[model samples]
Target: MCRTTVANPMMNEPWQRLPALSLKQLQYFVTLAQLRHFTDTASRLAISQPALSSALRQIETVLGVSWSTVPLRRSL
Candidate 1:
C-alpha cells in the first residue's frame, strides 16, 4: 500500500507546529474587521474592549501581519 502525502508549506513551517488559535480570537478578529470599532465589536461579542484588542494583537503577532494594513473589502 502506498500513501501519497500532499505538501503544505504552511504545515511544514516551524511556526505551523504551534498550537491552534482559539475560536474566541478568530471571533474577535472577524467582528473587529466587520465593525471597524473595538468598543462596538467588544460589546457585540460580549467581551471586554481590552480583551478584544489583546486578541487582535495576539493573532497579528502570531501570524506576523497587521490587520490594519490588510484591506479585506472596499469601504464606502
Candidate 2:
C-alpha cells in the first residue's frame, strides 16, 4: 500500500514573499497598462522600446502575471 499526504490549500501572503520592485519597472508597467502600446509607453518613459519591454518582462516575472492577462475595461 502507498501512502500520500495532501498539501495545504491556503492563499499565499504575497506581500510577505514578493520582492520589491524598482521605480522604473513600476513606471513602465503603469505606462504600458495605460497606453497598451509598447512604443508609446517607451517614449513616455523616455527609454527605448526594447528597454521598456525588458522592464515589463521583469515586472511580469516578479508579479507572476502578464500585463495583458489582466482584464481591463475602458470607460467612455
Candidate 3:
C-alpha cells in the first residue's frame, strides 16, 4: 500500500496575502536581497545590470518605498 500526505491548505495560506510579484521582479529582488550588491544581483538575474537596476527602480515606484528602507534578515 502507498500513502500520500498533502500539505494542509491552511498551512500555505500566508502566501495568499502576499502581493503578486512578477517572475522577473521576484527573481531580481531575491537576488538583490541576498547579495545586497547591484552588480552581482543583476548578473544572477540574467539581465543587463542596467536592466536589473531599472526593474528594481520600477518596483520601488510601484510599491512606493525604496528597498533599502525595507528590513531583511541575513540568512546564516
Best by TM-score: 2
lDDT (Cα, tens digit) per residue for candidate 3, span 1-76:
9999997788678777666679878778877888878887777767788898789888897667896877655568
Q: Who is ahead in lDDT, 1 or 3?
A: 1
Regions more than 4 Å wrong, model 2: 1-18, 68-76
Best by lDDT: 1
What order do you get sorting by TM-score, best first?
Answer: 2, 3, 1
| Model 1 C-alpha lDDT per residue in residues 5-64, reported as the tens digit of each score | 988767788766875678887787778788877788989999888877788889988778
Off by over 4 Å in 3: 1-18, 68-76
| Alpha-carbon lDDT of model 1 | 0.80
Error of 2 at 4 (Å): 30
Q: What TM-score would every model get versus the actual structure?
A: 0.59, 0.62, 0.60
lDDT of 1 at 48: 85
